[model samples]
Target: MTDQSAAPDATPRPLDHLAAMGAPDALALVDRAGALSFTGLDRAVGALARALDGRGLAKGARVASWLAKTRLASLLPLACARAELVHVPINPLLKRGQVAHILQDSGASLLIAGAGRSGTLEAGDRPADCALLIEDEAGAASLAAQDGLPASAADPDALAAILYTSGSTGRPKGVMLSHANLWLGAVSVAHYLRLTADDRTLAVLPFSFDYGQNQLLSSWAAGACVYPLDYLTARDVIRAVDKHEITTLAGVPPLWVQLAEADWPEATAGRLRRITNSGGRLPVPLVHRLRQLFPAADLYSMYGLTEAFRSTYLDPALIDTHPDSIGGAIPFAEVMLVRPDGGLAATGEPGELVHAGPLVAQGYWQDAERTALRFRPAPVFSKYGGMAVWSGDTAVMDADGLLRFVGRDDEMIKTSGNRVSPTEVEEAAVATGAAAEAVAIGVPDDRLGEAILLVVRGDPAGEGALRDGLKRDLPNFMQPREIRWRADLPRNANGKVDRAGLKAELTS
Candidate 1:
């Protein structure tokens, strides 16, 4: 295993670093609609931050966003960081109920949403005390015409954002990240990825996700352009890459599968210099296919969590021989394998993957019980006494220090790059009143990599109604792709649903 050490002088915030680059005229963000230069982006963010401050929301108060990957969403975090308010980005695909839970849980005072998405917030039944700000209006000249408010002085250790992770309970837990945590994560990723001023990145994932948000931070920190696209087809990605001459593209395994299947022009493929995979591991066949398609790009296979932002990444050079390995720790962080007995595991031994160092988040917001369970004291031989994220993911480190993912220690299902809780789906299914008992399992899917499969013991007559009920209760990604009628779900000796056995039934 690699020796654990600290990085020297990791002090610069992402926005401050970018502002100091002195390339204000360079492209910063682009979409199918248009582009924003660095100068334009800075002015817009400044105006929005000032506007948010003028609303009298206290510093460190959570400002939630329910929007797509628009320029406003791209710039919200930076503005929040400057104003010393925590930005809570709600996934645009999330249902109103889920959005309401996040808003209430975070106690967000100001909510910024798109003009069309206002109905979602209204339907969520949030408290009347919360103020609503439209993204379109905030970006317009009228809001900018108001007086500029001074930026709030914030400590680096203060909370910046609360990202909710899918949990076994019906409710999601917020992963608390500080300014220093996010800033260092951006620096580490940018340094290891070799992002540069001339590079342009394509962003397909939502900013609500940790890995997805880093695409904006790291690229901008390097003074590079980030093109955010909401793609509907593989052809859309190809067109975006060619149209923008994108040098970097980050995606999950499902996206890689689609891209590998879609025919790409030789000229378009040659322009992409880096391809990053996270959210889930890419199969060997898909990895080889991607290598063949983008011969000029370096492929990086990464593994991480919302709590730590990132853990390990397999180097592009090792793809040929160790395609499945989730390599060693990136710069500014330390990853360790802790055995069940609460001791360090030897090489080749399976254990819980432990992440320690600067990138570690503050903990779960307002959920002390869960936070205390996951975030604990660092094991012996650590320089700092801060909390280390005990990722409930089984892994093993090779003698050469490369980490390989085994499986989840918890019963969480990662489908379509979103971490979903089977219990959450089952609860929603049972709540529909059609199912006497329900079990949700992730079955392998060609398009999503993993799709939710619901096994229900219910009236066959109500199956259609139950499906419709789930649609209203869950996000598009959380909804089951298929529903199977069963007399009863398989159970273990403890009487709980045997998710593994259920998954096997579908796959076998």
Candidate 2:
């Protein structure tokens, strides 16, 4: 990977970062609205920035967008970056209450949405200071046609976006990110993934999430064409890949599982050159199946948090030997496993994963307590002494300097004098080829203190066979006390398995 430590300081203007790459006629983005070249994208972003700036808002004011994945929504991020306004993207799946929480928390002065979405908000939901700007096709075209836009007015340290992530138990918290964070992240991921102008990326993830947003930034950094998609099913993704001849695709584990089970046309499967995954671990069984399904594509298993955008990504070359590992740090990141006492964790020891470097976010917006709990100072061994993100997720570093995700620090199952990772049990069940999806949770028990409860979604007739296999594969402590079969498991807006929702339902 290219050294990006000096990239943020060397290029303060994010718009200029894209300009220095290549010819202006290179393709940058593609959607139903058609393709946008680098020069066209720069001009459109500048025009929109001018329109937003002409609204007389103060510098660094917050601007929120709650719309579906569209060309306008895609360009708004770069527009806000050039205009020096903090962009807050709300997931289109969120309800009015959730949208209200984000607008209030971010102190957003302006809100943009489609007419249908804007009508969903109740009176008094938005802040009194906020103004509404409804985006219609005509309105967007007019805005993009404006000329004589002012130059970019942002510093590298200024807030670029506030991405609100769902908290375990409470309202979502907005993670603050700076221009340097977004710029360096785009450059770093593009460099490591080997993106080029010939590649075409299909973006299926929501722009509200950091991982989803990176799909656009990284592709643009390499002057590649990005197709923003709001797909409904695996078939939709398959059709898009076939139609566009897509070369690069990114997905979370749950989505990957759905795609692996679908019937793929041979041509579509071979069209994919690279596939990257995050949001959760790719189950070993799914990994093997994906390898067989997409023999020509390189599968990259990655791990990341919203606070740092991304931490580690396993090299595609090592997927055969280290199918379960999350690999080492990505570019411009210093990933160190730190124990609870603030010391380096020895090899094979489980500790909190801490990420330090330019990729670190600027902390949560307007939530000091939650920020303090997740973001902290760097350890004494670091080359630089700035703030670092203390990822609450637990992991272990092996002797080869590779990282393995154990489980969330808060979600570890403590039973019978032992700490067990739920992922370990869940992965073990899926590896037996009897279940499509599995979730393991600890429940109250009179004898074992806490017993393992396995929730699976697959054929009901196969439960007996799967249970028999689990008994032979797992120890007594790791075995599930009961196996519950369901038609399907719930998923959050970001498409992760809804473990939190399951626990809440059990209590209710």
Top of the candidates by TM-score: 1
Model 1 sits at a Cα RMSD from the real structure of 3.3
Position 125, candidate 2: lDDT:
88
TM-score of each candidate structure, all chains considered together: 0.93, 0.80
Question: Highest lDDT among the candidates is held by which one?
Answer: 1
Expressed as tens digits, the lDDT of each residue in 1-508 for candidate 1 is 0112434347845342343332778888887547778876676667767866767888789999888887678878888877678999998888777788888889989777877877755644676777777767444543462444334456778888999888865688899998888878877887778888889999999899999899988887777889998889999999999998999999998888889999999999999999999998888888889999999999999999989888888889998889989999887788888887888899999988888988999998988999889999998856654789888899998888888999887778888889998888998899899899998887777668688888898778889889999988888888888888977778999998887787787889
Model 1 clashing residue pairs (backbone): none
Candidate 2 C-alpha lDDT tens digits along 31-145: 9889888787888787888888888888889999998899888988888877778899998876676688789989999999999988888998898999988889766755664
Each model's C-alpha lDDT?
Answer: 0.82, 0.82
Question: What TM-score should be assigned to candidate 2?
Answer: 0.80
